[model samples]
Target: MYSYKERSHIFNTLNSYAFDVLVIGGGITGAGIALDAASRGLSVALVEMQDFAAGTSSRSTKLVHGGLRYLKQFEVGLVADVGREREIVYENAVHVTKPEWMLLPIYKEGSLGSVTTSVALRLYDRLANVRKDERRKMLSKKETLDKVPFLKTEGLKGAGYYVEYKTDDARLTMEVIKKAVEYKAVCINYARVTDFVYKKKKIVAATVKDEISGDTITIHAHQIVNATGAWIEDVQALDQAQKKKQLRLTKGIHIVIDQSVLPLEQAVYFDTEDERMVFAIPRDGKTYVGTTDTFFEDDPINPTATSEDVEYLIEAINFIFPEQNVVAQHVESTWAGVRPLIYEDGKNPSEISRKDEIWTSKSGLMTIAGGKLTGYRKMAEEIVDKIVKKNRFKHATNCITQVLALSGAKGLNSKNFEDYIKNKAKVGESLGFSYEDAKALTAKYGTNVDDVFIHAKNHSADLNLPLALYAELSYSIEKEMAYTPSDFFIRRTGMLYFDIATVEQYKSAVVDLMSNTIGYSDTEKLIYQTQLDLFIDDAKNPK
Candidate 1:
């Protein structure tokens, strides 16, 4: 029932029933809360102003890493908590998360020397309770160069080798929300909460506007949670619950280049000349590197990579991989997102703590702000635990999400996923898919690839589109509730960023297919088309 066609029923359900919880945000945090609350037998509803994971949740560095650098900031607890949860997250969503060995190359003049990095990683391993097989390793300079031959060798001392989990952030949020829906949580995107309805200074309902239809409705709920990340203050002001402490937004950008340009075979987490850490990781024949953390005061809705940001990352790439001689032209695409850090006086954007804080307004609107992607489940558990203990919302149930497999992950574990995908690929090959394409689809969708293969089998011959694209679009529209071209290209398929050529090659066909399938009006089709064009242009040509 979690589809584009089911939105009317979702809205009706929201309006007719007084839910135990109404979560106003649909990023990973809100999705986590929805899943937690719903799994605990609470009737839950969630609303989002944009497509799911359209904000910071989608535009992360795409690592479920234990913040090793935070050890420098003395954030030991945060490091331990999010660090240990990495394996749990990997176990729960084996399809979206994978363990990547990260190399931290140490230089003569670098802030961290071999000894210090070794100590830090050891502390990190103990704190995170890393498994014996995946613990930290100290590599000699020769070994390190063998691992990543392109590294700068003039001042190289050694490197710290450790494990980090890579993830598709947007898909992770989607799977979490889909799992919540399976537990009967009514969630809708493109529904913006305009105002809160208060009775005797207690929030009882919210005035929400359907962004697509320009229609309004009031949803009744016993408890309302404000999980809007960067826009927390905006919603707080709407509730007239703006607090003294607020969000300090920071912008981070990443640049993607073909692997041929940089040819980085190993993932490197290295320090720039300015001593700030950056990551260069290879994915599907393209190596993506990023993330410049700087204060941003403009609109957080659509953060764009400035020329300065691109140049900074390019310089970092060249500084480490000097043989590559990478430049701006090598950049295929870029993405920028804002961090909704809780405001801290006199701290730089990077220095601000990543800890999450929960606050309740005078009208009882609970808001959560400032957390990492890896800590979402724990954050949700804490929030739900508070709600249950504080108000006795319903029959309290213990958190079961620790062992819960997300959508597409059922009956699959990290140990068995390789074999599962191999076996499933043969089945997909029998259904008009190439061996390689079948393997890729099986890997991406896990057990849910069965459903996607059905879509391919049923419609690929008739669609005049790539079988993979057709199947993905069909699955996204019917199961993932992708309503717009941007939702499909940017968040759902990630073609806009990782595989931009695929987007450019198939944009018109995709738009036409979506229009005919969903019956978009001519005006809506033009708007959606223009929106996708802007995204494509922005990815190619940064601000």
Candidate 2:
């Protein structure tokens, strides 16, 4: 359905149709809106300046968490809403999201005492409507150390363990957009909205620039919503609609270390000296710890970890796990993401609330800004609800996304995902793949693994790549619209961060394969090669 080869066709479709709703931005929020509006039978078109989830969505902490820290800020309502949405998101995309039990170590001199933490977690469970099996548990100091032996022994009290949902953020965005495509929503990345056309002081159409083809086209739409995360102000400026409540951009960076260096078995959420919280999570064969929150005023695109940000996280890791003696050299790779919080006077970056607000301009340009990844579905529902009520569309139905299964998740739920993956792996083994590799593939692609297997069986030998890697790369290009090497390495497969060795060894081969497959011109091939090398360098050295 969605393919890089069909981008030109999609652009032509965008130009010819008069859409009912146009969403600007291809991040999680825009993807969610497209899915919602299209499922409701409204003609929808979405355009993104870069690849889908290339911004904050790809560089997140990779969790659909309920924001347990918000409880400290007394934002109970916000926590409750997002916490409940976590189940809905996980149920809809079982492959991309999983329940990860988080350990919150208690300290004698820490801000949260055992008694207070117990009360807070109990309240959190009640507010989130947590499942009985996944409820919180109080672990004794010995048991806590058994779970994480490297934690500091000086101020050890105990731990409160609870469940948090870990997600593949970029993959989740791709699946949502693919599902939107199933509903006939026309969405394209690498398309920028240059300027808007208005009649009678109401926003009606927009002139868009295709980043790849060097062509400009105008798309007519009745209503347009701006959902770009950190670039919200930039879009607002294009419309000359600067309001009082603005966005305060904050940068957060995460550093990854090989499991050989950290050897962390369990995920730990610990307190730092400055009273800030940091998470050390183990995924695949690496342990990643983050993130340092500080004010940012630079470009949001390709934001890299600074020396100070890297040092801050290193210090926090050394403080919590003092025995590890983790130095800057141990950091394998790093990523930095920018958060667009509502500007609050006299508040620090970490102190800003993570609440969302919807603003409609005089020209009827609606904008939604400042929400968490956990609440994207609900946020989309709220925006579409407003649009339907304002337009008085009698045919539009209420939100059904709460029960909708995303692409690759049909007939699969949390209760049966384990069995589904196990059975799917057998099919891969029959197709001449190792069970371990097959199982990993099934977990990553869900029901779509069959397509990947077919690609591997047909083309792996000719492509000169590993069976699994070739399958994934081919599937991404043909089915997921992955155009560049960075799109595949960084977002599609996450090998850039988790397994840098694979990226370094196969970079040139991948470029050659893509150049041949997609017919990249010489100039385009050189540019893409340089861009991917820079990203790999940035991940290793930071900036």
Candidate 3:
């Protein structure tokens, strides 16, 4: 597998090979395409402008489900398709994704009534092909309050409950990319495509510039795929392809608070006064509430949560969980993500369908746009199959990603993960990690826990880092290709969202470690530190 230190070798391999498919993006969609293509005996190379998952993939509501809200939009077909995909995502990456039973609290003047909510949930369960044990159920007012004590009781009729999977969206994307690498896909980050290398107006390769080294290389490939999520237009301009269809970006933000501040017992999806649904899901030792859908026209790469977005989320939380008394001060961290939904006529931001589309330009640059996280696998499969069928590439292997476990989920299934976690936690404890820390590490790394445990136990004393901290940092560097402190804090471990205090506590040591490990000069160290500081600032104190 490619490590962070193997940048030169990876670059050499990318430049030297004539790739069958060149993927231009490192988010989930691009990662999925790389994995699927490589697993089927295709030479694949992928490039990302920033760190992997630095864009919208890391900043999300972090749930994998068929869009239950789409039911309200009368997108029943989309709901059913992605509903089935939810299981495929969970089964493939069981460690990062887990079932979260969500409480849909019904109010008198809310978007859904009691009977209507129950009927909708039941239909949803059937359409999603939910297992019998995970089917929907109607809860009484008492049951609803019992599940979520902080929920407001006034105007509460009843609630419809269903299952949704919660996940670390960034980790999921990283793991997919790692699996792609394990299948021999040459992938590099901080490598941005500056221009297209065309042969007689047909895109034959791309000129990718290494953002870190300021060196450009031409990556020759028979086929090129543009899977840049929000920056779709930016890539399309390279090929000068624009037709009737276009991309409309919408921003969604989530705020994280320590669980001690407002302890939530259940994950609740409730309706705001404007009839838009928001989710308050609890994870680790934090409670996160999010996702406002409003049209946005700003820099897509680094979208920040505005005061208005934070205030709206807080107001929605207060409306649902009034007793919790959540305020702006209670917010610990925040993240804003933009959705690249395809432009639709006569549809508002919330009403835009999240179905993905594939367009092949006259220059043979295939572009995929407007998909949700849950449907990444199928979207990749569709694009690859189209390329294969159109004589762009020669491959006959069927899609086997349905059964391929992600990097950290080898030899595990949903039913046995708890036991696997317990068994691994003991091993971690024997290696001097506390029970809690051991369990957390085992859960994070899954089958890859042994390397982390060894690194944790054998960490250098010169660094003055904790056992778990050193382990995660070293494992991230040697195994996960984490190039910067922001990559470690934000995406690799998700400390920015769930444990902002940890990031604040260890930022200095982490920067020093990265500087020493990657042999960064003082100038490079300062630049990386500044980047991390800005991310911390954005998460802690939004605009």
lDDT of 3 by residue, 1-543 (tens): 567779988987888989999999999999999999998888899999999998889988999988999988888888898898899899889889999999998999998899888888888998899989999999999998888887889999889889999989999999999999998999999999989877887889899899888988999999999999998889888885533257899999999988897788689899998889999888987889989999999999889999999999999888777887888999999999999999988889998889999988888889899888998999999999887775646564778898999999999989999999999899988888888888998887889889888777567677878889999998999888899999999999999878889898889999998899889889999999999999999988987
Model 3 weakest 10-residue run by lDDT = 238-247
RMSD of each: 1.0, 1.0, 1.2
Question: Alpha-carbon error at 444 in model 2, in Å?
Answer: 0.8
Q: Rate the local accuracy (lDDT) of all candidates.
A: 0.92, 0.92, 0.89
- Cα lDDT tens digits, model 2, 391-480, are 546678888899999999999998899999899899999998889999999999899889988878566465667888888998999999
Of candidate 1, the 10-residue stretch with the lowest lDDT total is 455-464
Q: With candidate 1 superimposed using the best TM-score fit, by how many Å does residue 25's alpha carbon deviate from the native?
A: 0.6
Q: Tell me how far the alpha carbon of residue 74 in candidate 3 is from the true structure, in angstroms, after superposition.
A: 0.9
Query: How close to the true structure is residue 22 of candidate 2, measured as C-alpha lDDT?
Result: 95
The total of clashing pairs for model 3 equals: 0
- Worst lDDT 10-window in candidate 2: 236-245
**Segments of candidate 2 deviating more than 4 angstroms:** 240-244, 460-462
What tens digits encode model 1's per-residue C-alpha lDDT throughout 382-414?
Answer: 999988885557586889999999999998997
